[model samples]
Target: MLHSEFYLFEEEKPLRCTVRNYQENDFQELIAIQSECFPPPFPDELWWNVEQLSSHLIHFPEGAICVEVNGELAGSLTCLRISYDPAHPHHTWEEITDNGYISTHDENGNALYVVDISIRPKFRKLGLGKLLMQNAYYVVIELGLDRLLGGGRMPGYKKYAENLSPEEYLKHALSGKLKDPVITFLLRCARTPVTILPHYLEDEESLNHAVLMEWKNPFK
Candidate 1:
């Protein structure tokens, strides 16, 4: 699909931004934005290197996207197609992504697996994350896929990790009682939690756990 045809919906303020596919020239800004979004140890295990980023563009050109606001890289969402089976177990981010290289991308797969979504710290809270997710949903529909899947890190859950399990924290977040800045927004967006993936990442923020979430395409 064309970049102009990807994000069909507009935000309230209509961020004067251009959402498009990743280009080779975007490498430096992309890495800068990623580093700003996740600093220190957080990015140590998550940020993609030059080769990995290049591989994404080469392997899944259409699935990797970025949002440019005022000539600056605001945010990006990287994903790839995968054939999934609900009867079988879901794979961890490392397993599915080949440790972030996206070597496992399957063009003929029926599900869109989100590898990463990063927004510059200054650009966050401006509905960019939701915008990125909406674009992913559009990709799913465009590809005639069944659903979108990914491991959602609960950055806020680390505060309660000593008391609540990831599952319990998810219940509270989904119950509309206690709100998690990330998971709550995702749940509100119609993404359902399937299971808790332990040791999903080395990031200390999520206590190394992540919620496996899925957004089934209602149009399918």
Candidate 2:
């Protein structure tokens, strides 16, 4: 399990921030967060259900956590353990995460695979997403894992799909020629781009493609 409490100063006011494991009571808020973050075209059916959340708490509580700002639930980061092989890292999000149930979590896995990192719309722009990611990194260290891995959506890709291939789009995003909301954020978090994952998810804006990214554990 991972738990941390800290503070963030915004406009000279202190905001109490706490990161803790998911409790059964926070279920409703977690569901609302998905509705606010992923709207139409992003299948509503993909939202987390009680069963998946239950599996997270049961399978790996250390990999499931939420952030609260001033006593309000603000964001969450859900993950699962996996023995990853860099040489053969190709896999869909559903396949790797067992369609978000995370039943595939391996107790002896070498890497922490992040299934999702979501922030409440109103709580965004407050660095909570990054904060959630930082906590996940801590989970990696605490669990003695080798790295953090995830498939990040290139939400800005569809805008250039007619003119650029997914690989070219990723290269441009990495080179700072263009900014992709998800890819850029991952880069800022110090994650290295591995490759483009075509048909990674049913994301229209991402053209169903995601950029596989990883942050090797420095302490490992």
Candidate that scores best on TM-score: 2
- Clash totals for all models, in order? 0, 0
Candidate 1, residues 1-220, lDDT tens digits: the string is 4365223224554445778998889898888887887887586647778898999988898888998776678889999999998876456888899888898999899899999989988777677888889899999998899999998888888888888888899888888768876677788667898888888888778888888889999898
So what's the TM-score on candidate 2? Answer: 0.98
List candidate 1 stretches off by more than 4 Å.
5-15, 43-45
RMSD of 2: 0.9
- TM-score of each model, in listed order: 0.91, 0.98
- For candidate 1, the 10 contiguous residues with the lowest summed lDDT are 1-10
- Clash pairs detected, candidate 1: none
Clashing pairs in 2: none
